[model samples]
Target: MHSIPKHMPTSTVVSASRGRSAQEDPWWVRWTLISLSVLVLSVLVILPIANVFYHAFSNGVAAYWNNLTGDRETLHAIQLTLFVVPIAVCANVIFGVAAAWAITRFRFPGRTILTTMIDLPFAISPVVAGLMFVLLFGAKGYFGPWLQQHNIQILNAWPAIALVTTFVTLPFVARELIPVMEAIGSEEEIAAISLGANGWQMFWRVTIPNIKWGLLYGVILCNARAMGEFGAVYVVCGRVIGKTETMPIRVNTLFEGGTSETYSSSFAVASLLTMLSLVTLFIKIALEHKTQADLKEAAQTHQTE
Candidate 1:
């Protein structure tokens, strides 16, 4: 048995003294929460981004414009980022899709071990990832001397940068697509096969359409990571100024070099990246909404039928 206090509710008694409400979450609490959130955001994300934009655009609109369109080295760095992002993302996309399919469709020895291995990069430091390639491909590395004798140069080259980026970003696409694939199940695929659909047709019609959102989500995330990869690229590519410098590597060099002229360009690149990330975020949201809407329409159609 329980007893309600005399001052408390029989059927929600109203308190007329001191204006205290029955609910604990008052307007003051809400405002307090909003204020706290604004404070933290102002310190963390907003401030940093504002600083970048301020530096990027501070020297007037024309200077920001010139930061991008005027500098050849900066232009080259941007091109390198563009080139590496696609290659790294595509490699990861293929491997990730395959890995997801393997995990969902088959039972095999060391499957759990392999899945854990996929998450290794997430746990380990990026500096260690660079060291891994360095140990494998550096001048006196395990096979480095042997290869170098024959004029082979995997390290300090674009291939090394691309490979390292691909390896590091590999887990992103698979991580995104795996749960979606597991939830969707292979029943539709089996059904497509039973109805005499070919492999390509079944995949295109049944497999891709369902998981397209997840795939896109993974690709966007991976591209973001690949574009900004620095430690590994620095180690492997040797930061050869205009040649091997991606956006991040270029920014670090500019920061190190004290190039005031390049600071705005760095911020411009950063802002460009931020814009791409926002676009990716929107795509993910739109796809998720569309997927939900499609599911609802399907349920309605079935119910009506």
Candidate 2:
């Protein structure tokens, strides 16, 4: 130590230099990271939101409010949207829970194929989704004759419109629930049965509690997707103005006609959608917390018993 080497070994110098290089990220690297983050915000988020709010408020808040309140068509659209969103979401909720049960709880033949079939909508074109109904319920569709003969009136009808929208969104609830269900497994179900719980009781008490968050989150997604549905609904709906036109269809019509006022009113309507999305976001957060708390509580209760 007293006679420390006059010159530090070459290896020591190189090692110290490498450490310094690791500690100090290059300016280019930092700049690239910052640029990417800013670009993501600029393109994906900021632009669309800017466009919506800009058009919505272009005529000032007073005009927006007046349009929302006085326009019968707009008012009807909002009402119809509220009416359809819940139905579609609820349909997805029951079906999704059922699908999750079949896929996770029981082993069935063609299960993988069925799972893929369930996800088919995600891959198919929305226009195709709409066209499918057109083929099925349109004047020349496979079932069109029978349906028309029965006076079904699915084409250009709200129920028809709602069905198409529901079809497109059915996957939402299922996709959300499946993963969470896989994570949960049948342990709790088996546990419940071990304690003398019957099938109905086990599902109502154990299964529902465990997957409630998944269901809630899926509902939020389904509702949002359904409310904003355009593709399949438009094809089947005939955009029958006061009867079957959804908010998105209205925006397209207004934009095509170059009606600034109508377009702006449409955005105000879209702002209603935005409000729903925000509410969904909040609900998702709340469900996450509730699920975590429930799991922790169950764990503590289990330990004590």
lDDT agreement with native, every candidate:
0.81, 0.81
- lDDT tens digits, residue span 88-200, model 2: 77887889999999998889799999789889988888889998888888889898899978988888877777788888997988887787777677878999999999999
Measured against the true structure, the TM-scores of the candidates, in listed sequence, are: 0.84, 0.83
Off by over 4 Å in 1: 1-24, 291-305
Candidate 1 collision pairs: none
- Find the 10 residues in a row with the least total lDDT in model 1: 13-22
lDDT of 1 by residue, 150-187 (tens): 98888877878898898788899999877777767787
Lowest-sum lDDT 10-residue window in model 2: 1-10
Regions more than 4 Å wrong, model 2? 1-25, 285-305
RMSD of 2: 7.7
TM-score for candidate 1, please give it: 0.84
